[model samples]
Target chain A: MEKIVLKNVCKIFGDHPQKALKLLKEGKDKDEIQAKTGSVVGVNQASFEVKEGEIVVVMGLSGSGKSTLVRCINRLFEPTSGEIFVDGQDVTKLSREELRQFRQQKFGMVFQNFALFPHRTVIHNVEFGLEIQKSDLSVRREKAEKALELVGLKGWGEKFPSELSGGMQQRVGLARALAMDPDILLMDEAFSALDPLIRRDMQDELIEMQQSMRKTIVFISHDLDEALKLGDRIVLMKDGAVVQIGTPEDILMNPSNEYVAKFVEEVDITKVLTAETIMKKSQDVAYLTSDGPRAAMRKMKNNAIASLFVLDKQNKLHGVVFADEVAKLIEKGEKSLESAIHRDAAAVSPDTPASELFAVMQSISHPVAVVDENNKLKGIIVKGLLMAAIAERGGNI
Target chain B: MSFELPRLPLGDGIEAVLDFLVHNLAFATKAFSAVADQGIRLMETAMMAVHPIIMIFILTALVFYLTRQRGVTIFTFLGMGLIWNLGLWSATVSTLSLVLVATLIAISIGIPIGIFCALNGYAYKIVRPILDFMQTLPAFVYLIPAIPFFGLGRVAAIFATVIFSMPPAIRFTTLGIKQVPKELVECADAFGADRWQKLFKIQLPLAKTTIMGGVNQTIMLALSMVVIAAMIGARGLGGEVWRAIQRLQPGAGFEAGIGIVIVAIILDRVLQKLSKS
Candidate 1:
């Protein structure tokens, strides 16, 4: 089920009503108004659904409105106009008291600066949300203690925020949010203020928490690499609008626009795309010996094999022996498979897309073999599969 | 040959003002009589309500103990003894009681006003200039108008001292409260603290130091008015000093001044320690 959804969300700022009206009247598009007045349309007609237990990351640069977008989701800053539904309830129209109640029960936000009360001890700070909700003192204390324990700050609960290091203070902030037992956690650059090493640790910690709690999270960050590392689904935003929303593989291989492509260009595709993407479907055809020229040709003619995976009895790929190579083997009257087979064959898994596969193929001077787990032959993706994928995409096949 | 000293305009104005003050001695006498009657009543009430001598002894002992200096203790004891020796012990106690009462009242009124001013820009705009005027005006200036309204005695002294001392307390309290960090306020807000909760838990705790500075200033200002208060019929070491000065008894006047200094020192030290604590 979708946990949160935004429909036609638009956030425009300025005192003048006619400013937006005048822009519209003058046929000056959103870009013009955005540039002219520096009155940002923070989230422009943004529409998306985040499924339950999904980690959705909103990724952008500093002025891309990622922070504004996240804040608008919680109505920390009210949207200019939009419908926001969290767990199927339209929360935009909620009264102040209703909104407070909703926030108390449903949402937990961790800010970039941690925002822990300096005067309060860690325990008191963590218990603040519960206290505001008017929980009994003992119950609030117990819950706060448990939350501190959850955040690995059990013994340090009595220390004030100033007494703790930056990372520890951020842990207290997290504990405060967790004490509310919120359904959704909104992290607005939660680890952005930390040092790079600490940020990596915090990212790991968040992932661990998400693994156990299964809380739906919407994390905002300007760091693309952080988004790639933490996000189950990334929404790349530019100029207050979503440029692309997809899995890491989808974004890495099939970026929605030039902007998104530029963002993904420097990423190492081999690390991002898995073997499942480009691997061909398993076929029932027999494997061929490199020297068995007549038999390979016969098999190729009968099965219409573009190329056959050369494997020993263990089903491990030795190399790919193409039909043309088999024809050459036949001409040379080769008997041994080793002599006829090309040992240096480019290979990809089913998960690899055409872009990566083509790149790999271009670099290697051999037909690309498709293989599955345990290095077992699936099917050969010679120039043909790449051509088909490229053709299907209406490009240079 | 004769040398003539030139009479400056300012000096002439001063002499004229002094002559006018001397001519108004009758009104001063009337005001003093009224203050003396009130002082007697207050002392009788204090004696009946709480043993004044015992309270004085305990306060002196506490001051001496905290100060840990024998000179201060001896001076305090001798100052009280001198007031008793001058036959003004009861009147001095009455004046001390009135000052304390006035200070307490001022704190109660001023702190809230200060906090209000600090919180609201409009209130600060309105009250700031008034506080500036209150602070800048001479302490004796407060007595001139106060005499006609309250008719002298403990009420007039209290009215004057309260007006003189309140500005510092209010201003400092407001400044202290205002100086609470913005991050702290935001933290409280994020934690869902309501207005009252935020003020009590966050702002007040953080502003404790600054507010105490204000309180200290208020106490010191009140002490400074102790001698000036005698002109309005405040009976204390101030009355003794006034009597000694009138009789041209330098020894008595010096002793009375010493007594006033001792009391001021003890009170100031105790309040300073309290502020630190």
Candidate 2:
């Protein structure tokens, strides 16, 4: 089920939103509506869904509606029109008190500038949400300590925000959100304030955090690399509307528009497109010993493939056996096909980049077997597919 | 060429209102005046009970404690000695009592009004001109109405002092709170802090330095109005200064004037120390 669904959410910034909304419904452009009613469209019928435990990154430039879209989900901006459902509850239609309660109980937000309270110590900052809920002191302290520890800030709880470095302050911010244990996390450019090195560190930390916490997160970012690295699905916005929505590979391979194309034009597609995505998953394989040469011949005949992957009884990859090798083994009446298993087959892990695998692919004529760490065959990456995937890397991040 | 415009009768309208208040709101006015009288008398008696030498020592100690400046502390003790040598210690006590009571009352009312102005733009618009008039009106003009309503006494003196001293307290408080960073206020809102929580937790603490500045100004203005205050029969160093002026004794007037300056400087220092964040 979708954890959050934003259906045709529209937000206009001006005194006469109703009049501006009329023009918006009439399909007037943002500039035309703005000129007529003196209103700026923040989000124009932006719609998307975030599945449970998915990290959906909203990406855009400075004037894009990405920030406005995420804020509308929590009713921070009060979208002019449209419905927002969070975990099946109509968050858009919630009363003010209900919205406040929803924000407190369900949403944990982190910001770009690390909005830690200056007056509060690190522990107290982390405990702020619990304090708002009027949780008892002991419980707040316990949860705050755990959260600080989770963010690698266990011993620094007594220090105020001013005493901490910029990176540490942002860690405190992350801990503050984590301390709440909320179902949804809304991060609005949460690491943009840090330096590039620290930014990468924070991204890695978030990647690690989302693994265990698995909170449905809607992260807003302007950096394409950050979005591509973190998001399961990216919603790229431009001019207050959704420009495209797709996985990193989908965007890199087939950009929906010229705008999406330009956005991905500078990105290194190899870093974004993993070996698992590049490999063909439909290839057939034979057991190393249990499925003999006869079985391999029949499988190759049915699939009309020249070669097959030989696997052991445990499904561990033994080697690749060609159709001719299997047919010769069957003609010799050898029930055991151990001699047919060629152990010199080239293998690449699923996480190995297509760039790194191209050197191996160049020396071999057969498909490169993409395997897991356990030597089990996952899929195959053909030379033609690798060349095409690499050729499709014209876009930027 | 001179052009003649009809007189506006604004003064007459104010006089009529005051007249109506005196006649119709006699009981309310009496109750308010009585409460103020009791408070001033209480502070006066408390100051009087201590010996002049003991008071000087105590003032020196308080200065030392608050400011932690040995130079300022010694100067405070010497200043109190100068007032005592002038034979104006009793009158100094009375002046201290009046100024203290007036400041307490003014700040009690002014701070809330300042907060109101900061929070509500409509209230600020209404009170902006009122505060301007209160701060700018000549000290003598306060007595014209003071004589008719409160009749010449410490109550009238204190009433005038309150009106004179209140504007700075209100203005500084409003400025201080309004100056609190918008981002911090937004952060507070994002955290779901209620209005009162936001005021106390975020706004008031950040505005501390400036608000104390307002209090310090109010105290100075109250002391500056001392001589005018004594014209309404309020006893103090101001009374001594006024009496010496009436009798044309320059020597006595100068000594009393010196005493007022000493008290003003010492009080200003103590308040200044308290204001630091």
Candidate 3:
């Protein structure tokens, strides 16, 4: 389901926006229109869609209009011309009052500078949106408390925004947005002001929250690495226009133009390619509860592998059974593959970075098992496949 | 030969307008002035009833409570004691009441107008020139119409002082609100805050220090106009200085002038501390 769709949106900032917009429609570029009409084109006929439960990062340099574009989604910056549809409703057609009400119910926003009200306590800042919506005092307070807890500031509610560090202030910002429980989150360079380490933690925190919450998010950023880390699909914008839109691998592997290629060229692929992206499908595995030692041995033989991953009825990774152990168990007439299963096999969550795989794989002789949160086997990463995945991505493997 | 431009009738035109306003508006103005006169007298009597020693202690306590600064508290205590010792305690109280009432009126009107100007560009454009004219006009100019409207009393003096001191509060308020960070305004808007919500919740709170600075300036401006107000029968410390000057008693003039200075400094320090808090 599409949550937000912007069509031919153009934002001309000046006294004569309509005149500049007319020139824009006549195929005049931003500079020509600016020189001719003295109107700067903030966003020039940019179009994009954000799907429900997907995070789409709008990445660009300083003047690329990413911020303007995101603001246009909620009509914070009214588009000079074009349609903005959110959940099938035309947002541009809304009256001022209607837009205010619509924003209260549909969207949440976080800003780069944290934009927390210095006069407000942390909990009060978080409660602002709910209070605007006229929610009950008790209800909003409970929601605000829950939001603060969600952002890991459980006991810092009474502190003013200035009392917190930059990272914690941003957490308050995120909590402020989350308190509204809006369907879509528009984050404008939300973590750009933080130190690199804190920024990374915030990115991980957002991703972790998104795993269960699954709210549609449109994140604006200038840093390529941040976009790659957080965006499910990346939108590369330039000079007030969207140049390319694709998944991280699609963008890194096949940039639409030289500008995008250069933008992503400096990024280290090993840090981005996670186990989920690089791991191959496991060819053979034996059920620990149902399969006998002979079945494990036969499966390993058929796949021409020395060992086979063992799983129970729930498809959880029980362990790995080496062919030698299986053969010994078969010679001893052991019926269950559990006797042959080796529980010490190395495993990694699917989201672990490929760079970390190198460290984990160095000490393990067998293939690393890629598992989900429930320890269910998702894929396998043999050493050769990991190397090939890196080399294929143009890494210095 | 030098050609002279025809002398504009600007002064005559203003005089005519003032004449018309005086004729048509004096009834309402006089009624308001009576009420204001009664209020000032009431306040003056209430404040004067307190013993000078008691008043000094009360004021020092207030300063200490507000500022929590040992230096300022001591200065306030000594300053009030010196003014009392100079036999100008009653005169100082009158000046304090006049300045306080005028400042309160200026702030009450100025801040809202400032907020309106900040939010509406058209209002600001229209008001900006008027504010500049009010600020640049000689302070005594307000006394002319004030005399006819309020009839030569503390009310008339307060009228002129309010007009003279109001510009800073209005100008500062508009500037402070306008200077609130663009990103913060955007954040407020993004959260769907209404006009009132945005003003009270974000803009006003952030602009507090600047607004307070403006109020402080208004009070100081009001104080500066005291001697001029004395020319219109608004007697206080200004009256004592006026009498001394007329009699050529330089010692008495200095004593009264120093008394005004002490009062101004104490008020300024207390207001400065309040603004910071």
DockQ computed for model 1 against the true two-chain complex using alpha carbons: 0.29
Sorted on TM-score, highest at the top, how do the candidates line up? 3, 2, 1
Q: Largest TM-score belongs to which candidate?
A: 3
Q: Calculate candidate 1's fnat.
A: 0.34
Compose the digit string of candidate 2's lDDT tens values, residues A162-260.
Answer: 999999999999899889899998998999999999899989999998889999999999999999999999999998999899887677778999999
Which segments of model 3 are wrong by more than 4 Å? A286-304, A310-316, A321-341, A373-376, B1-5, B70-82
Tell me the tens digit of each residue's lDDT in model 3 across A1-397. 9989989999999999999999999988889999999999999889989999999999999999999999999999988999999999999999999999999999999998999988889999999999889899999999999999999999999999888999999999999999999999999999999999999999999999999999999999999889988999999998898899999989999999999989888998898899998888757788867789888778888889898888889989988888887888888998887766678889999989999999999997799999999999999999999899989988877
Report the C-alpha lDDT of model 1 over A33-106, residue by residue, as the tens digit.
86777665666667787889999999988878788787777777787777999988887998877877777788
Task: Report how far residue A172 has shifted in candidate 3, in Å.
Answer: 0.5
Interface RMSD of each: 2.3, 1.9, 0.7
Between 1 and 2, whose DockQ is larger? 2
Tell me the deviation in Å of residue A311 in model 2.
8.0
lDDT, ranked from best to worst: 3, 2, 1
lDDT of 3 by residue, B76-169 (tens): 8998899999999999899988898888878999999999999999999999999999989898888888987888889999989889999989
